[model samples]
Target: MHASAHVDTFARDHLPPPGQWPGLHFDLPELRYPARLNAAAELLGGGVPERPVFRTPAGPPWTYGELRARVDRLAHVLTGELGVVPGNRVLLRGPTTPWLAACWLAVLKAGAIAVTVLAQQRPRELRTMCAIARVGHALCDVRSVGDLAGAGIPGLRIAVYGGDAPDDLLNRRADAGPFPAVDTAADDVALIAFTSGTTGRPKGCLHFHQDVLAIADTFSRHVLAPRADDVFAGSPPLGFTFGLGGLLVFPMRAGASALLLEQAGPRQLLAAIAAHRVSVLFNAPTAYRAMLGGLDGHDVSSLRRCVSAGENLPEATWRAWHERTGLRLINGIGATELLHVFLSAADERIRPGTTGVPVPGWRARVQDGNGDPVPDGRPGLLAVRGPVGCRYLADPRQREYVRDGWNVTGDTYVRETDGYFRYVARADDMIVSAGYNIAGPEVEDALLRHPDVVEAAVVGRPDEARGRVVVAFAVLRPGARPDAEALRAFLTAELAPYKCPREILFLDALPRTATGKLQRFLLRARGDTGVDTDGDQQ
Candidate 1:
């Protein structure tokens, strides 16, 4: 089936070669969508009109009807006023705000592909995305407009929001009638989400219009089982896929409201949950761990469902949270290439250490280097195929990701006899020391069990005797100081001798990306500087 021709074929033309794409499966009846569909219409156009759609601490609540009107008006401004045409890539850079959410919906409503970037990104990163996507138009937060301007993309048109600006999106005429959503094909590229690029240059993950709703219908509908009355809250920036699904798509799909906080730390998130009566929480394990320290002061009884992704959730963290709140952390493993969670379990089905079975409408397996299924309980590459899969825009690495009709995520895992998948490490993260293969996350998980350790990241350093030696960077809990020898001894009780860290370096905090994922590559860069003999210093 040929996709409906887009006005600007830049994105379609640059998609990975047809044969390199994973075999997308939508066999489930609910997964089947019409050939001509607009995700913006499906996600935001049909909801409880009088029900609140978004609420912030200081801003007035926006009902579904109000958000729809704002989106329609913005669509008119983009098409009628700014002359945006179908297939045009519009860059969106901003914090998590109602305006930013409306702008994203408006871009899709206007038949343009949305290219979102974190507001915290520097000029260099912005330039890279702009050049790669060939962006000609942008909607930026007022505070980030200067950085967007510094990107120096030729012929770029930008409109700022959230502050006084001559060309602010909020200032656009709202008197116009509702602008009709564009009739985009189901397979038409709707978003170009760039990867976090911790190891290398960020690659654009092109998602189709149908891919947007697939995540909500499959994961949110089946795994999360959200209700229309649930109020969602989270810390991930909207630019990230995890955040997009958590804060917007999932809630909107369930006809629920989302609490959009511009800036959310552990403290602020806890306060919002109590103040707004938020019931559904989504954040990384690090944020959850941080919140554990302050849980005594807040009434988080309002939160019924807590979702953790973006990084592996250690069993220690999961057990601690469950023990305290009587709510099991719903751990999921997803990637930008696949849109959202594909492996997860909710409620009673959740197993503390394993990242649940394949989500409904998806299939997963562990495969060896030759693309054959590995034996159960043996570690190998994780491969998945489902309603949503990878399609990198013009990246040569596309060939490496999709093999034998499966999206070979760079993660290593072991599938148990009962079909539960346990994460071992990233394919590139396994450390080989003296003929022993060790997963860095396993060691980090062990260190986190220590009472004084708040956060831990482990990497391998080159050694003269052994090929590599495990090293760890730890963040101590407030007012708790533990020496390196004590941490090592603590690890000795929990981990095998070969799996323990050779040295532990204390830092104020572990380096992480905007989305709270630890940057092990950065730690590896510092690992070769020689192990610090003295412990409690940054």
Candidate 2:
């Protein structure tokens, strides 16, 4: 496939003209702004102090009017007392709390970009991010003990928000002089979120101020479609875009209540949903799979919409979930480079094995080695373009990610004529065994279909003769563990011999990012990669 092929694949006949379906397509109306503050100000109508914006089971909910006061006070503290200068990088570390939301808005209101990090990140990772972003200030909650202490976080100044607001801190008077919103250009870097690549080191993805709202417009407007009366909940760390957008931004943007929890495991998520009447669930497929047991026992009638991402939605996982809950999962693909999901589909349009069409406002095409678009149902590298285009900040990785004005993500995909894109595998995860180029995810998807398997990941181990051999790691469902021979025979019966894993390694769990993606690089990083020394495969 060549670039010309991409042009042909998405020609006028294949898609409506650009911006053809106004409300259904291009979502510039909700997010068309230079800074993100406009989203709140516009929602509030600037008359009645913005309505209440936050809700939680642990404490009283805060309204939009009250939320604004926090952002204003924090912004004043950032500039007047804390000295967070324009364009400064202020690293924010905290759980999913109102304080966290305020910190995010405050940093932007004060003319600084908030650099968020996973509270679970080790010391070395924090140092790397601080150095790359040139962090000037840090706002963290001291409550998190142990490894999340920010031991290696280097900042010119540090402010602790949770313990208490200091008396000396700048708190705005009701009539304090015009604390006008900071002037921000559409191109200004609003955030620098890091996503771990196939290579372990996390890559910082730059997002503009305008992007803050584009995600809600695209995610909430087209995908989630949450009404003002809807209640929201998700299982992503606040630092992760998947979590931040779904739990915080998306609901608030629509004047809905977003349930926040310090922890959101399978049990916690289901409980929260039932308790708060949470109407939407935004989490990974793995979380959904894990909750199947509780779904059978819990009252989840409140959950109507579920969004699965961060990893491919296994066919079996989807079937089992839908079979148990009687609700189809809305599967989508999102990356840090694109800010939010550029390709997604509503549940009604979801195809079992494929990630549905390129989102309304976005254009996606699969290209071959020559960067030409591949025909429908054919596999190729995936590229996408939309209103929220790729613009990295001082990084050479951009050259490889963006070519011909289309952002070439690291994944492989296929398009079908009915308007859906299928996942092949990550370009880095594709293994070449003998003469065949095999996709690890495709094999893993097959393995997951087996009733005994709970989670699975496939990678290639180097071989002197075959060039590479397929290696799979699987986690079994709670009780029934089949013996090695039976499992091997089971796999052989299910898939083609060439696509089957040469060896299987069973484990309690697979290595995953905070967002719930299988980290294949870690599996390949193990010494004697094919050995499976744990001997848990059986």
lDDT of 2 by residue, 1-538 (tens): 0111111121112222232211212445654454324333333332234455667778777777777776776777777767666667778887777778778877776657788877777777777877766676777765542343446454446666566455322332333333466655554566778875545456677665666777877767887788877878888877888877887778777777777777889999888887888888888888988898787667898888888987788878888888988888999888877777878888678788888887766778899867788898888899888766555544556667777667788788888887688888887778888999898877887888777887888888998999989888888887866455667788888788988887777777888765576777778765243445354322
- Assess each prediction's global lDDT (C-alpha) against the native: 0.90, 0.72
Worst 10 residues of 1 by lDDT: 529-538
* Residue lDDT tens for model 1, 1-538: 4465379989888988778889989878999999998999999865799999999998689999999988998998888778899999999998899999999999998889999999888998888888889999999888878988887888899988888666677886655687888889998999999999586888999999999999999999999999999999999988999999999999999999999998889999999999999999999999999999999979998999999999999999998898888889999999999999999999788988999999999999999999999999999999999998899988898989999789999999999999999999999999999999999989988988988999999999999899999999898987876488898888899999999988888888888888787888888887777545333323
The most accurate candidate by TM-score is 1
What TM-score against the true fold does each predicted structure earn? Answer: 0.98, 0.88
